[model samples]
Target: MFAARPYEDVLMDDIAQQAGVSRALLYRHFPSKHALFAAVYQQAADRLLAETKLDPTDSLVGQLVQGMDIHLDYFVANRHAVLAANRVLAGDPVIQTIMTGELDALRARLLAVLPLADESARRTVSAVLKSWLVFVQILVVDWLTEQTCSRTELRDICVGAVLGALRPLLPADLVPNWPQLAAGRAGA
Candidate 1:
């Protein structure tokens, strides 16, 4: 309903009617519309993370590809929901805190997988990976709305960009196979 209607017009009564529940019941669960929106946003984020199931045993590049695929798939599937969430969360401090915390957790998990030689290197690699991921996400959103390229083609572009950006930070052996794996993804 949030996606279908303007946020200001999506009242508790609208949600209650849509859900076939009483307004009182809905309010009992979510004190305000903002709370309900936040809940939905958090649920979507959690669902996206759960669907990815990043494997620790996989190579870093492989894991990154899988993660990006999952992220792109989610955005493609739930573009409106994502847009609604973003709209509702814009300029909201509580939502911003929640998003930041979730991202920090994701960063910690990714940092665990990267083989950094020292604390400084680990921090540098983590920052680079975080920035790369954000860039890829923006690209994915643009691709989702534009549909200028097929998912396979977009995946190849993303993989290439990610691998190129990480070449200096990643192991030498891993860097060489990045392009090969990306190119061969259609076959696999």
Candidate 2:
């Protein structure tokens, strides 16, 4: 119910009716409509993290592509919920924390896969990953609203973007042969 309809349109009474429970029982569990929305959004975030399987054998690019595909799939399917969470409840700390937690977990996975030279590199790459994740969130949320580009193009742009952001932070030796960079160099 929350995923399909705008958050403002989803009443506690309706949620209770859909769940085959009375308003009393629903309030006992969630307390309020905002609380209910938070629970649903948290479940979605947890499921996304679980589904984004990162194969250690795959290259960084491959892993990013896989992650983006999974996320994009969710975003497309739950556009209304995502928009409500991002726009309607933008000021909600609980909602923001869920978003941050998911992004931080993703950053840790990316840091694990990066070929960093030392603690300094790890820290630098972690910062870059943090910013890139936020960038993706904003861009993708905007895309959900306007759909200015194809889903595949959006995914590719996200993957390409993080790669571009990380290129400067990584060691010089690692940059030249990085998959997309290599392809780009050949063309240049």
Report how far off residue 102 is in candidate 2 (Å).
0.7
Question: Would you list the clashing residue pairs of candidate 1?
Answer: none
In model 1, where do residues sit more than 4 Å from their true spots?
Answer: 2-11
- Per-residue CA lDDT of model 1 for 51-163, tens digit only, reads 76667688766776787778777776676655555554557886766666666666777888767789988888788767766677567667756888988788778778767
Give the worst 10-residue stretch by lDDT in candidate 2. 173-182
Candidate 2 residue pairs that clash: none
Which lDDT tens digits does candidate 2 get at residues 76-187? 8999899998999989999999999999999998888767889988898999899999999999999999989988778877877887788788765433345556456347
**What lDDT would candidate 2 get against the real structure?**
0.86
Candidate 2 global TM-score: 0.90
| Residue 18 CA displacement from its true place in model 2, Å | 1.0
